[model samples]
Target: MRPLSFQAVRSLAAGLAAAALTGGALAAPAAAAPVHAPGPVTEQGGSGQGARLHTNTELARELKRIEHASHGRVRVRSIGTSNQGRPIWYATLGTGPTRLMYVTQQHGNEPLGTESALLALRSLGLGDDRESRALRSKITLGIVVRANPDGHHHGWRYNYDPGADPEYGEPGKGYDINRYHDPAVAPDDNPATEAAVIQRQYAAFRPSIMVDYHMQGRYAFPPPDGREITTSILWPTNDDVSAGALRAAKQVGVRVHDAFTGAGAVVSQYPGGSYEGIARNAYGLRGSASLLVELSALPQERENFQIRSAAISMVDLARAAASGALAGIDPARADAIPPRGPSLPGGSAAAARGAAPAHDAAD
Candidate 1:
């Protein structure tokens, strides 16, 4: 990548310095995903259950607003179709050397990320900020605004069509898309006709850095206190992630974590070695610095805060990558944020990290 603009470089340098002083503590990831507050291309006035969740129709309307307002700033497209034949849409801006991809609503119930995503797209397309321009110039951003429209429409997690399930539990019970990126095991045989629409985006986009967004019941990575938590992040818990790539992934994760914390959002590290078929390990193995961002529900807070936290973290990390702040990071340090959570006694380390064996998450 070309040298980052002076401002970008300085911003990166300062962040690196802060990281160094903190001994790379920023590498920790947050936890869980949640539902959204819905409306017609508008911001949430509050948090938690108080915010209106977006119905599929509402989301479609919002996407339309983005497409209409983008002008030439973003290229909107239907990457593929869901099992129910709903189109999976994306908004792409920039042609920078590095491609950054963010896929949200992977779990049909997890719509919180959509709020931040819409806000980000609007800012980039309609707003004229120097930072946004610089960041876009350095990174191509591909956003799968909604990875599972079928689920979104029905308020379910699995795609209803036979195409969404190959082998597993019943349709709605066994179609968790996050659990299907093993590459080695295509669960019941991966095929365009069977593999998920989001999987198609993963294959086609081939981003340099990928972040998958989801919301979960509030709880620490190890279910600490069984209480809810905030945004969670995870690097590759498996051996597939290269040392170098892990470092880059950590670099971005750390920056994003700091961004969230700075914004006053609750954040934590997802216990590693736990979730096997996750996008982090899946795409990381395929050569991308990937992360899984989980937002906590249950003790759900205001939706606007959650969404903006996600949006800020994403844009901040993008800028870090574009500015080369993440390119040359010390992978060792990145990897050393120290794994959290206790392993189920006798369970593998992966157990402590909350990872289940491959091919297990149809729920």
Candidate 2:
């Protein structure tokens, strides 16, 4: 399939955004698979060969290893400690002028982002190829893997902060780290500890771009007729976000859409609220070109595929930013992406591919 450019897709925005097309130009996976397909090309190539969802301890060790392997080129440090006393690790690669920040696994269950980011860190720190060297020379990449280590250990959404205020998260279970990134709340005054750590890092780095990675429940336009969505993305939607920053964010979104779609994955505009506390909106309000990428949480059998999809996104976008192509992309093209369709019953990818016809429902 010939990939559509922003100019080509803009013409179909009206119809594409309105309804699920049965037989239009919407691209499907290159192979016979359901909506939760992985990208055809990965940064490291192969089927996510060595990617493993790491434990917090493993993550720390891996970061240190990458740091050592880079021979001081890459820096790894503990930003702060989580509620459970685990180190909230942060790693940086490259010394370039264009700064990029990526955070993954604010929600513990969404593990693919962390896995993919590890793969990306390995490639950036160790690869000696021209692209890797160029990326290192042109862009400084900072990544916070498993930002909410407590929640990740618990295999739940919020961080482990049982004593948090009622408005923090679930009060007893833990605070939802995602909801406490409000720029108005200074790091010292923040309720969620992990969020505060991220804020502190943000203040120090002040990245030009911020990409928050997450995973959504399985979703597709009810099988057979409608294709399953592989990934959904959104630019900062907060009203207070500056126009220029917002446009840059949209250009980033368009770049992401092109990257994933070209890799034979379905891409859509994420249905997100304009909550300033959410990382994407909060970071945008702080003058960064921010974006949220939600890869579909496919079945366990396809875990590697999901990792590859996310790695491709991270690596490709970095390359784009490094090469200066990101600045030339049309922000208006982001509007052409269709709003995400319904979540499959029980949030099952299998159900998404095999379920009977049904009406759209909120995720």
The clash count for each model shown is 32, 0
The per-residue C-alpha lDDT of model 1 at residue 360 equals 25
CA lDDT of each prediction against the hidden true structure: 0.59, 0.72
Write down the TM-score of every candidate: 0.73, 0.81
Candidate 2, poorest ten consecutive residues by summed lDDT: 19-28
| Runs of candidate 1 exceeding 4 Å displacement | 1-51, 162-174, 185-195, 220-228, 272-276, 298-301, 328-363
- Model 2 residue 101 CA deviation (Å) reads 0.2
RMSD in angstroms between candidate 1 and the native structure over all alpha carbons: 9.4
Worst 10 residues of 1 by lDDT: 23-32
Give lDDT: candidate 1, residue 319. 70
> Where does candidate 2 clash, by residue pair?
none
Model 1 per-residue lDDT tens digits across residues 216-292:
44443355443234666777767757776677677777777666766656566766453446667877887788887
**Model 1 compared with the native: what TM-score?**
0.73
